[model samples]
Target chain A: MDRSAIIEQLTEIMIDVFDLDDLEYRDDLSAADVEEWDSLSNIRFMVAVEKAFGFRLSNSEIESLDNVGEMVDLIQQKLA
Target chain B: MTDVLTLPWLLPAPADFRARVRALKSAETVKAADVTTLAAYGLDLSQLGSLGKIVDARREELRAEGRLRPVLLGVAATHTVDLVAEALPATALRHGLLVDTVQTDYGQLAQAVLDPSSSLAAAKPDFVLLALDAASLGLARPQFEAAAAHEAVQSALDYVASLRDGVRTNIGAGVVLHTLATPAESLFGSYDARVPGSVRWLIARFNQRLTEEVVGDSDLLLDVAALAETVGLARWHDPLRWHDAKIPCALDAVPLYADHVARLLASARGLARKCLVLDLDNTLWGGIIGDDGVDGIKLGQGSAKGEAHLAVQSLALDLRRRGVILAVCSKNEEAAALIPFREHDEMVLKEDHISVFVANWTDKATNLKAIAQALNIGTDALVFLDDNPAERERVRQELPEVAVPEVGDEPSDYVRLLSLAGYFEAVAFNDEDRKRADMYQANAQRASALQKVGNLDEYLASLDMECTIAPFDDLGRARIAQLINKSNQFNLTTRRYTEADVAAIQSDPNKFTMQVRLVDRFGDNGMISVVIFDRGLDSWHCDTWLMSCRVLGRRVEEAVLDHVAAAAKAAGATRLTGEYIPTPKNVLVEKHFEKLGFVQTCERDGGGTTWALELADYAAPALPMDIRTTIAFAA
Candidate 1:
């Protein structure tokens, strides 16, 4: 899958985790943008993402990523 | 009566089920599915992504979906118990529970149990679970031959018993007790495992003590130690997690723990499956007995295939000892199927162990119906296990209540797969459990005897039966409450009572509670009857009356009323009044009061008969059987 496709799937997972409605997914959208995406949900969201994508992200990779765009970039680099 | 085959659809087709389980891509999909639907799909522990995260939200979803069967649980842990509390919601969903958990202050099980203002008292949970660990119980690092080690175990048990007694007296909830888990970090190195004095062996005995203590009591023992064994002890606990948060169980192990707890609670509620229906052919042995002769089948001593089948057989035998009836439902020639069980030297399950054996080419759904009829149990109580996926699917579509375990292709995986499903969840173990296999065997004997007799009266007379009627004792109270809570057919008022309620009835000045046990020429049907009657100034009012369906139509009802009339007379009553409240299942007892010659004076407001019998003309009815009766602790 292309990077944009991976980004789209990841965005859908975040929507499910936070139960987001009337929300648009942007490349720069981060945990701070969503009210329900607290630290616990952040871990839960990432775990769901990893499960959906069939990969594991280390703690450093999860912490270092700033936004949805960076997380999508990490996924693309892994697929490469 | 609705036929088992015509039951409404419960599970989807297997391929569709697998597809649905696979399609659970996100938390939204999972939360949307009902608890039973999730369990039917059989998602693995890891397949469910971070169950801890979704546990709370799923509670509301479960309620919204109307899939929530609530089990208000009281949890008093000796250590950190957040993981168990967290895992409970999702894991309990597998067994169909909302799992309303009430937590006590850490290490304050006694205070929580005693204090009326405590959450345990206020929540009034249906069940109480004591989450114990070795370190908290003071047996983590005992000396090899230390006397203090044994004393400490005894003291811990007394402490737990007091808590159970307090709950029984105050709240009337069933207590679920368990022993400390044997840590993976053994103090004595490898060789000392077999030594009786070693910590490992001591821990094993401690677990046995825990189980034995709750054998006849209203309490149940959760086999967390067995759970720890199934999932290796090393994997069950995390040292860092324990150090940081005092969590005894690992995050990953929480789901499995919750599953075990849910099973115990379900069993307590009398929802456990009773019979195990087995398929022959590749299921019982390595090869088909029809093609391969008795000697040709691999089930005995040496090979891995043989050992796997043997393992399954051994588990079946263990299940039988614990009161799970075994029956055969297979698509093979009856004689050929008998060859493996009767003629084969390696067979662990003999013909005597099985309650009903139906071996024919007919579809298993039909055979299962015959087995249920022969055993006189509901189709819901049956657990059909077969290796053929097509046969399994057919049965699932036909009878959804029958628990069809996902026994994979290999014989090696059969035992592990069935054990994980937790179909045969048992509440209490007594002499009755050990004698259950024999009772069913006696049913077969009774059937043959009935066929030979000329009429129903003649058949009942030929049995040479004895009924022992007595007041409630400590030993029989659990079984009494068990029958009161679960017995549907032949129940008079269908009044559900806890063990504490039964205990209260015994202690009350005006109330008289009694239990009846029967033994025929064949075997003892343990505690087949229970009655609670209230003594008024000039009248006796029946509060709760129920008899086990196992002893129905054997003149036990006549004997029960005869005994009650005498007791009512002795207690200075002029008249006896009984009520028959109808439920969907208790239609078998619709004419119960009328049968005893008690006139139905009127019907109650909520649809039940108010029956009255004048004690002036009361006389014991002459039946064809011999009876010995004692009324201990008479009113």
Candidate 2:
């Protein structure tokens, strides 16, 4: 999937899983940007992102992720 | 992506009747009919097969047909003559209204005339029928010697009477009671050797004690079951199939059942059957289609067995014609079952008559689950009919949630079983029941098409989607509550709410409630979603937000945000905020807002993620999916 498409797909999943109606995910969007983005949500988000992008995230890696932009980059690298 | 509705057809039952039952099963109202003859099958055995579900299906059918007539439930006539006078102006219960059946035998015309209350003048019954079996006549147990026994019978009688003549005049909406005598056989079993006089004596004694308790007019009527024995004709297990006998003809010599049902016709409310999930084998016709070829299938016009099935099919067709939904769940090979509907000349039920056909060799319980899923209905709303006790037991064991019936064998007395259960009895008919089958069938087509699209955006774009988000109102209140109870996935803060709860929220101005409806290229996802926001000073909070999983992958979430942001901005709110409360099933969308553009505001102790989006700077992403959005001004 294209990067923007992956970002878009991530956006859809976030709105659906977290149920946030008002959310914006640019490449720079960080953990501080979303209301429902927490540890558990982070785990869920990571799992979902891994599935959607055809990759996996370790506990340490998931715990280290702090923003949407970083996660997007990680997913992009995995895709590359 | 096969539309199950369009799949090959099966069964010998009429298509229309099945359709009507299917339509009513999902109705909001609960319609109840009388089931007099059902007592013969023995409640335990009757409850084992389609009997229970059929009865319940009947109630749903009644509701769907909008035949929710006021009902009058009549109890033992011999025990409570005062039941009628006490039962008048009855109160409506979950089942319907109750009425006292007339106490006096029709032959005692002088007694009916003499007793002021017994006189039809004081006690007008839309229809009066006997409820108890006359078999008790011979067993004439003496008056309750114990207070507890006395209270038991009295309470049962009192409950029956109270239901009939409660202060609530609208108790039995369209139902009525009538006066008639119990036939000798009804009091005595078909095999009973008791003489007629002895039987009458036993019944008279039984009635005398009950009548002495009350001083008012006995507004009750006698039914044919009090006169002659329904014997094998109406009884559930008369092994010697009386080939040439019709219920009218069989009752000609003993008109109690006919007369009572006819009199009750005044209160005859149209009962529609909802969701008739039928089994193929011995229940629908004489033999299994798999074992018995199309030529051998006993449906259409000829033999008694064939005729019996035909009679049931005709009844189902009439119900469907009046608005019932039909479905099939059988254990036979799909190909063999389809042969009857596709090729058999005498088959009454066609492919279109059925809303869903689950023809796999899976257990009936699993099949029923699939059926419920396909119809988007609760398992409690279905009535499964089968001829095998073993299959019924499996369903009862594994899928205890689905209602199975007691009437497994004995297809000959299918009509009588319905009359006895009164589960499908109704007072009137409605448009919803009639159109429901078609609606569900249409839904099947939509579901199949939806499955063909890949990914959420592709699905959304293909839908040619249009969404309307509005606050809770009278029109969508019930739908919103139903979604709260039904929707599993794509539900945020899965707060279950009932109609009353929704009403409470709608009445509270402080709580802002809204719902979303999506209509795509295929059809309307009737109220596919809902959202509730509690507005705070600087920021708005999400009270509840949920959507149907069917519409999940689409950028509809973006549309919801776009709409919410606009509303928040219009309301002068600085920020729009929401939280993600993770439940095991909803992990699929936990990161929803990070993708949307909302910034994290706070995290709760229990792993809750709260995010906020500034109203001034909120911008929607370039959604790859095509989606049309509309906002209904909050009222």
Candidate 3:
């Protein structure tokens, strides 16, 4: 449940939700960068992330996240 | 069939659905059968969305290759229906349907139905689904007065009626209506039932009124309120999701919703299963009946385990009451299997309830096929229930078409799982459905009588069969249409007709239609056969010749042919032509024309053959049944 561990698990979920081959973890990585990541898929991605991290995300928390770094930070804060 | 025991049952849906999807995607060509097998292990919204992508691609490939023609389903909903549409194709695959859905834009259900030039009308779907919610129809709002509430319900129903009539006149599609699910939020808590204008009261009234209005029609009703109540209203409705995405139900419940819709559609298309094949030991009752004596077996009112088994028997009996054929395919000795049915006082399913009973040491897969054969139904029309996982797995491997639900070790779970499977989903029920069990039981009596008599002709003579034949009239139209759709094994040219089509044929002067009913000493077999003959230049062409498989070996077809030939001769036809069209289930009638002295004139490429019988050379076969006819024929 450390930052890198969360990032690693988060990358696996993104890969599954977006059906991507590979993804590099970075703060700049966002929905616009992935072609398959749309509004509908974002809902699925959020659900998968919540399930994987064992935490629920509020509607505002889900909407406010802008990048992989923000999502990782939210997960870390929620876990804390 | 014996080797099925060596093969493993289908693996349960993997814990990691994404991994399974990846594995399926990695294959060179993902087969429809593999996708269907995966779909059979129900999925959640995310899993359904993932699997639906594969189903869509596979459907396109099959349609492009001329291997599939999907049923077009136009979905119009008050909320966003993308998720339901996404889940449909994969869920439909479980019911042997490739559904191509055209979804109307969010909150445009009324516009889609009213506008003649809309995409829903242009696509001309086989079924138009009106997926409405209580909130969308304004039934969720509490009216201050009871009269206002009544007016609200009436207006909502009137609006729905307009939409249904629009779909029928504009698109010519069958309408699928949804019952409004009462919102979880209640104004007065338990006291909501007392208020006429309460959300719960209004929604319940609307649902009841909708159900009453569509009872005797072809409109398919998806009881979403009942479904929501089953899953708990709190779990079924999500306020956050509704506010954000405009989704009708919770995302997790979309798969079940899609499955119910698919079952209704499948039932409408005559794909609902007909029989429930059951195993005895640890299934109907507790403990092995053979090992434990009748008095020793744990089955009656004493213990919790015994009552659980009794519940299973009660469910089977209820299904039989609804015309679903009950059959027994067990591995125990015949006498041991019969002991519980005959001597046990606690048994709910008696010997008379089961249509076909096969108890032997043979493997279940082989015995299941025999049961299907005895019932004259396709193996696909059977749902096998057994407590043993190994036997269930073996049957699943041997007969992939037979539905084998994964009932865990709990006997109580069997009823829930089978009920949720929707295997015996039905759209219509008539008098024939009520008497179906009795008809099949009488068939079993005739079979046992044949064995005792030791001669077929002597058995037929002892039965004292009487045939009442008449032209197709209004009274027998419904049964005639049902027989046309259901009879496959003993059907020549396997042509299906609707009741409307049968009515049209009844009035056509150039066409001759016969509805045949047979009765013997055992019991009355109601309207067992239908024959339609079309007059050609010098011959009477048999457009449809089908008989109930129960009356097959009794030479009912021969007697019907005798009457047909005599009628054709009186109608100034020189020859009678019949065709044998081969379908996967209709192989039993391949040589029907040839055996009836009709010369094979041509054999089509797909194993279909055309035969002709010259009227001058045709001789009526000696029939045991006393023929009674209302139509005139050659003396």
Among the numbered candidates, top lDDT falls to 3
**Interface RMSD values for all candidates:** 7.2, 25.8, 2.2
Tens-digit lDDT string for candidate 2 (B88-200):
31112112222234444534433343344554424544433334333222333323234543444454445434434431132222223321233324444552324333434
TM-score, candidate 2, is 0.47
Supply the global lDDT for candidate 2: 0.53
Candidate 3 versus the native: TM-score? 0.89
- Give the higher-lDDT candidate: 2 or 3: 3
lDDT of 3 at B439: 87
For candidate 2, the clash count comes to: 125
Measured against the true two-chain complex, the DockQ scores of the candidates, in the order shown, are: 0.20, 0.01, 0.44
Model 1 chain B worst lDDT window (10 residues)? B1-10
Model 3 lDDT, full chain set:
0.82
Q: After superposition, how far is residue B309 of candidate 1 from its true place, in Å?
A: 2.6
lDDT of 3 by residue, B128-214 (tens): 998877776888789979899999999899888889888877877778888887788889999999999898899888999889975
| Model 1 CAPRI quality | incorrect
Give the Cα error of residue B239 in candidate 1, in Å: 5.1
Please compute the TM-score of chain B alone for each predicted structure, in the order given. Answer: 0.82, 0.51, 0.89
* lDDT (tens digit, per residue) of candidate 1 on B1-635: 11111111113224443334334424464442433545544332332333434545455655555434567888988786655675566556555466778899877777888877777888888888877677766666664555765776677667667777777766678788886677887655886576554667667767878677643366788877877876778877667557645768665565567677887887776667889999988888888888989888889679999999998899998999999999999888898989877788889999999899999999999999889878878787898889899999898778765788766678887776677778887777778778888899899989988888959988888888898888887778888888886676778887777777777777788887779989899988989999988889899899989998887789998888888888888778899998998775678888988878888999898787899999887778898677667754476
